[model samples]
Target: MSDPAKEYKQLKEDFVSNLTGGSIGEINLVTAIVPVSVLLWSVLQKRHSFFKPYTVNAFGLDYLINVGTVLLSFTLYSSQPLLLNALLIVPALAFYLTPPDSPTSRKKPDVPPKAKSKHGATATPDALGALPLKPFLTTYRGSMIVATCIAILAVDFRLFPRRFAKVETWGTSLMDLGVGSFVFSAGIVAARPVLKERAAGAPASPLAPRLVRSLRHSLSLLVLGVIRTLSIKGLDYAEHVSEYGVHWNFFFTLGLLPPFVAAFQSALAIVPSYAALAVVLAGLYEAALDKTELGAFVLTAPRTDLLSMNKEGIFSFFGYLAIFLAGQGAGMYMLPRNISPRPGTTKGAQRKTLLLTMAAWSAAWAALYFFATSYDYGLGLSVSRRLANLPYVLWVAAFNTAQILACCIIDTVFFPESYKAVDVSAEEEAHRGATSRLLRSFNRNGLALFLLANLLTGAVNMTVATLDAAPILATGILVGYTFVLCSVAIVLDELDISIKL
Candidate 1:
């Protein structure tokens, strides 16, 4: 008889590669080990190239050095965090992009236009002509993120020093270096050839420099980039949380996205009725789940001290919300011509709005905290058994929804898409895009967040839960790491790191 467990294992392999030893921590370390090495190699070998300031490729060796060391430190710790308490700060590398093959190596092949129109094999700019080079540039963050993730998965070095001593574990690092880089790059740049190019009059290449694309294009591109990064991180993070036996809830997170996005779009839709309908769907699903034992199964998985670490407890109904919300926000951020090129936008109107929103969030939190103390508001979800509690879900959703609305508004008003020019024969636009930049940025930096979040969640579970210090340390390490992560992200942004992976 065929073993169901074997079939299940095969299916898992077919879909997602896991951490070593079937352990969450092992998986994290194994996946991270290779990425760290690649980053180190890239940093150690800093060389310049044609696309200097335009892409993540520009970070060169330093990108590897900084990111590599970080990954290595995280994965190395069985229970120890080397990155922060190192008392030893390694200098971040300084370098720029360089393709595997040098520009000089290419004598410039006579690249003929592949697309030939019937009019005497001539070319036209209307999706048939040569285009100008894209002037916009996405930071190299995406490349680093994907590359590192690939590296981690490829490599399987043990975080514990004892495990590292083994020969089998050693080879995993090299395997990761070889395979991870390719996959990571592929993930970030799966969409290069067919993206839109600018018309001939546009002197600059919009596609190459993503940020320079028009507002519509920019927003769309940004959303894609964000989705890619968040989705990857979200899934990965959920898996990590699952190690906690009860906290891992990516499905719960994902279930929330589709509806959130739908509801959000309803708000932005031509017909408000559509959005209202989406909300109805969201409510109905949760209600249905609430009415059934299935809902109970999702929220109230066997609460065991030992298994609780798995993080299996979640209202699956809300899992889709994250995806929906992220997608919806992206869609709205790509505004049509209605509010384009607004004047005095950078004058801080929205920034003030953001600040005000921040204050409002703080106040709401204080009130909620106080209310929870006085009245048992079921984990901040107003007196509900499951996620279907409308008041409970909306209370949290209010903030999430508002956050997206705010981001979309800001992006539309401030970060409009810029167009690129192309030659009918040989212009330099890589492709048309903008929204992807947000995602690309997210992708590149997503790993840092993922690692840090796991560490935090792990440590928190230890302290918060009745577990040993090991898990607590893991979670706390992440908590401490998060601050550093945010700062690094900000600095990377300042340094103009690539937003698109």
Candidate 2:
């Protein structure tokens, strides 16, 4: 009979939750039910097909699980951070331990018609050569990464699950914009090209058809966008405030631009070389004018809708757009499935690349750190949204991207081949062990661990003021709560809990 919002207020008094996309979040803001509903609907549509393998039903279930994990992570987030981190390690470990239901593990006749399934989204690679009319709707890595970013943004913006992170403007920018949104978005940038439409049987084009790629990207982001809005609604349930009209969600900007990408993809496809140069010029122009006192020169106006408008994402567009376009170009020429080891190559080139990326990132960071904190006028000015500060945005984007690329280089050095090798020397093994440990720290199972960490962190805050649970305890509960919550997630993820509710 008592109100939950009132109850939460009583418990903490000042919890900051700026939740984003709702379901899988727009796979973002909605409850676990939304993705299940979509997947079930898809399954129902195919049920009547005489040729519909019962296996397809299983794939639907997997989709449901993946989305469910997203849902679970947010639920855990509402509790604690450290607990959530611990909780995340479980499922990925289970996936590793489980006999990987390899692609060929079961044959058509052997798989119970109803039981055959796949874990990832429905990206059955296009057959040998022909381009599929519609690209795979889900399961594409790029779209998934994009969805992840939008979902997290939704979590930060729309919902007041735990508490808004109170940080110095710069610290807040670094934490929220830097590590959170920017880090995940970089993965999306790296993976974007992989999401493009590839014919079933043809030599893969350097770039996917722009329109198809854009639509695929946009549609996914849009669905996530709606969930983002819904998440805000949910946050209102717990913390009543009217943040509904604020339109600063970057997903909207991103979704809107895909059409633009599609429209221009074909034309620009011809002049591939100009793509990078154009983006660089545009970004510099946008940054200098909008991000500083000299912003007037670029003639870029900040957001000014009468009802509600944000100048962050779009106004600072050219900078990020440059990053994105540059990413696309890199995807076209740089990252690909086929990599060969040159005669003298044995981690030498990879190490060199990693070192260079570090050097660039470090140099950029020094310049940016000084410029970001010391400057009078910053990208912080918001015609659109405060969250999308241009200087902060570029600094984080460039830094994060550089870091990710460097990581990829290291990955290439160790992985030379995609699969794990049976025999290896101690030195190489030691190198891999360190990298693997680092990576496993944030791999997919990371969600479960993060949730668990949240709970433990909460419990710690309530009971003991270990250095770990200081201000976080400032909310409610204690480190003990953090421990228990994370314990649950770690157990669950490790078990690979298949329940889909």
How high is the CA lDDT of each candidate model?
A: 0.35, 0.36
Clashes of each: 117, 96
The C-alpha stretches of model 1 lying farther than 4 A from their native spots are 1-66, 77-291, 298-318, 334-501
* Residue range 83-149, candidate 2, lDDT tens digits: 4434434443443344533445433322211211245332222221111111111122222332242
Candidate 1 per-residue C-alpha lDDT over 316-389 given as tens digits, one digit per residue, 9 for 90 to 100:
33423422332232222221111124565642453344445444543553454345324355422222212323
lDDT of 2 at 434: 23
Over all chains combined, what TM-score does candidate 2 have? 0.43
Backbone clash pairs in model 1 (N, Cα, C under 3 Å; residues 3+ apart or in different chains), count: 117
**Per-model C-alpha RMSD:** 16.9, 15.7
TM-score of each: 0.33, 0.43
